[model samples]
Target: MNSKTKDAIQIILVILSILMLLYSIIYLVNYYSENDILTHFPSNKKSEDTDLLTPNEIGDSIGGVLNPIIGITGSILTFLAFYIQYKANKEQRKFFYIGLNNEKQNRIDESNKNIDLEKKHHITNLKIFKSLVSSMLNYYISSSQNIKDFLESEEAKPLGIHLFIFKTDSSYEYFNKLDFKNIYDSIVYSFQNKNEDWENDFIKILNILNFYEKLLAEMKNTYKIHSQSKAEKLNKVGESITQEIGYVLSDNELKNFDGIVEFLEIVYNSNPDNTPVLPEDQFKGTDFERLQDEFFNKYLEKLHMRYNETANEKYKSQLDKFSFMNKKIGVEKFQTVAYTKHLREVYENNFINQTNFDKVQEFLNKINIS
Candidate 1:
């Protein structure tokens, strides 16, 4: 039975026991008063009332009535004592279960805390690795002569040189004189044979590029997991409070108050749109290609300006070609203001030291690929 029912039964049994005791007391009082026991006392021994029994007989008569009532009362009292003990034991068991549940919850919370701490440590290590990869990429891009030769070759068709001298018949002589075909053939032979220093450098650069792609993917995944965990914890907190109070705090507002989102953005190097600033897919053409494109484009721009100032007939066809390509490609692609502002902060705060900062910045500036 339920505790409430058991309690009610116990109370009823206690009341019945009290009433039985009171009945027994009243019965004895009436028996003595009605029988006039004083009439049979030693002081009135000379009385010849044969109907009055001896004192011993009256005692036996009282015992006959009281004995059964006493046994019944004692049984009720005994049962009441055992029932009270059982209730005490039940209450103790209830408290024991409560304590057990509380201990289990504490253990679960401790495990969660350790897991969160481990994730944070992992994220920090990934950030360091990412920075190292970026530095290595910058170093290779700036120093690799194989990449430079490839850019200038006819096969690569360095964008600036192509625009300046290969667009029209009038400038074909300048392109032919550069002997880019021979340069292209030599680069191809060396790459295929893998016997040149430039070839080795090229392979190393490719390896670094591949590593960078994987690193970016891993970093993005880790950051996403960490951010989601924080969001879930915040949601849990919101759920624990009253709905009216929870509604007063918007999700974004709650995140702002915690500062976790902002901290994650900074740590993960994300743009304001929540996209990673240096996205994994960003290196599809490779940073080297972007660098080559930017370099040649700048070269053509300067050449065009020089030709305009000098009014030289010798440069007329080339400048015309430069103008057409410049117009076609659009100068807007060359604007690096946004990249410079964002990356400057990123490098200063997280990735690059002052020693490597200029090289990294220069590499970033030359990239036009979105």
Candidate 2:
């Protein structure tokens, strides 16, 4: 149970305990009061008159004894609820163990599936990179190598092709990140997959690379659940995650990411002190005017629908550079920049202005200095 449920149980236990205690006290007091009123005797003789019921009243007392018994039972139930609440609060946090149980198998299966997907992504990137490199290599060979020698020096030809493929694949768009796809693409060109003897071997290597990626992501998510934000252990978990995904992280590199993660974790763990500083924290003492202009121009471009939505709120709000720019920047003086105008400034001049755009720009420029 979560904290909220535990609290509710505790409260219910307390209320029931109080209610049972009151019921017992009230029942006894009312029983005596009614006996005095109905006895048809003076108040001082009420006990005497009630007692005079003698053998009949004495033998009719089973219900009187059972009333206290039932009250005690309610008291026991109240205590049990309290006990359960305490245990839930103290022990419910053992989610780590839960994950290690049957959940482990589930995560493994999930990891395997993800690995397969990553393998496909890696394979595709590699195929494209390999095809490009091989094509370039073959062109070079045809232009310079003797046709007789090309067919004869088969190993040499593929060797050159593989090197070129490795180099060109690194420059591809989606494979730039240090991900499984990136690693697979990087190593894939080293194999002579285009040759008839090599296709199956390359396919297996692709599968292995993908498996590593999934294993890494699952471990990372698990660590995030229980790891303290400021603990260096969390960073180790993150580093492990990256390494699992095929990044060649050095011990020192892991240390660096660990330090950053620890620092960020501290901010998060501090609760009420939440927000982490922007990546632009190092901008002070730099040339302000140049930075402002660069900020302004970038802000203007951001107003365009094609520009990306920046997550950097500080940069977006503080600079005032983009204050005039709406979802589009309206150029009050597009021609004012004169002969010095870059094509970029000329294009931004025609951006439209509107109410909502102006409102967001004013406050955003005040806060974001990026």
Candidate 3:
């Protein structure tokens, strides 16, 4: 039964016991009086002898009334003692209940305190994770400025001399006359060599590797997480870092960066759940193929979203051709030539207005994916 019910029953029993005890005391007192145990001071004395009155006898009779009063007062005092004991027991029971409730409340407060502490821990972890990701991306991009310029330059285009070196082009007079192979090789060597400007970038990469090593060890040792949501955010940071690592590794100039790809793969393979949402191998690209699919996908997704509402058939056709060339070009060729050609055609045909073309071009340049 519940505590309340048990307490009520105990109280009823105590009251009943007190009433029965009082009733029994009163019954015994009446029985003793009826038996006349105090009928005479001496049991052998008779009523006739006591009938003769004297001055001393009259004084004794007056004093006898006080005897009954004293007996009644004694009985009242005995009942009062029992009532006081019952009250004391009731107070003790109340104290016990209060203590029990306080104990429960204390436990609840302790649990809430633990939850708050854990929440703070998760928040701190998320902040650190975010900082690491931003720092890594910033450092890697800064270090890759030379490679970015190479990719965006006009000389890197499909028909440019730099690309034609690998193609079966008959017009090779400029290259033979200038001995451009040694010149280009020297340029590539200088770009790959670490200068003072790249010192901080190398440090950042090392720090990123160290952080991942520690994080992996921690996850292996501990099964508990303060917050699953924060853990998921950490995974996103990992993915971003992975993409930056791929971008650096894919560059022809930076391809010789030692062990970076392997280190990233180790961390990524260790936690499959946190790996980048890229194709089978992100860094396995040829020529001007961009390994950073995240940027391209972001632009493509936005493109579809923006045009889906307008139901623009020309834009749809262009998006389809881009998709087809993406697969055909694989990792060896740049899509800029084909993509720019298609945009030019669309503009000349007035398929898209000037505002839409400007918007699309701005987005392409913003993401550096065009």
Q: Estimate each model's TM-score.
A: 0.37, 0.24, 0.27
Q: Which tens-of-lDDT digit does each residue in 308-357 have in candidate 2?
A: 34555433442232342211112212221221133123223311122322
Clash count list over all predictions: 0, 13, 0
C-alpha lDDT score of every prediction, in listed order: 0.48, 0.40, 0.42
Ranking by lDDT: 1, 3, 2
Q: Which ten residues in a row have the lowest lDDT in candidate 1?
A: 159-168
Could you tell me how far off, in angstroms, the CA of residue 75 lies in candidate 3 after the best superposition? 3.0
Q: What would the C-alpha RMSD of candidate 1 be, to one decimal place?
A: 31.2
Best by TM-score: 1
1-370 per-residue lDDT for model 3 (tens digits): 5657656755665565566556656654553354344352324444553433443553465346444554555565565567567766877988999999999889999999996775555444434433443443333333234323433452244322221011122222222243334433332333343333433443444354444334333422331231232234334444554555465456553333333344444444322245653555663322222322432344345446646967776446534644443444332234345533543443334322334233333322322100
**Model 2 CA deviation exceeding 4 Å by range:** 1-23, 34-71, 74-79, 82-129, 132-370
Model 2's alpha-carbon lDDT is 0.40
2 or 3, greater by TM-score? 3
Give per-residue CA lDDT, model 1, range 1-370, as digits (tens).
8988998989988998998899888887877765666443523243566455567767888889888997899899899999899889989999999999999989999999996775555444434333444555544333233223422341242222211111112222232243434433433433443444454543454454554344434434543553354345433432332242233234443233322333334334454577775665552221223332543255455556656888875346544553443443333223223323443443344333433334344433432211
| lDDT minimum window of 10 residues, candidate 3 | 159-168
Quote the lDDT for 297 in model 2: 46
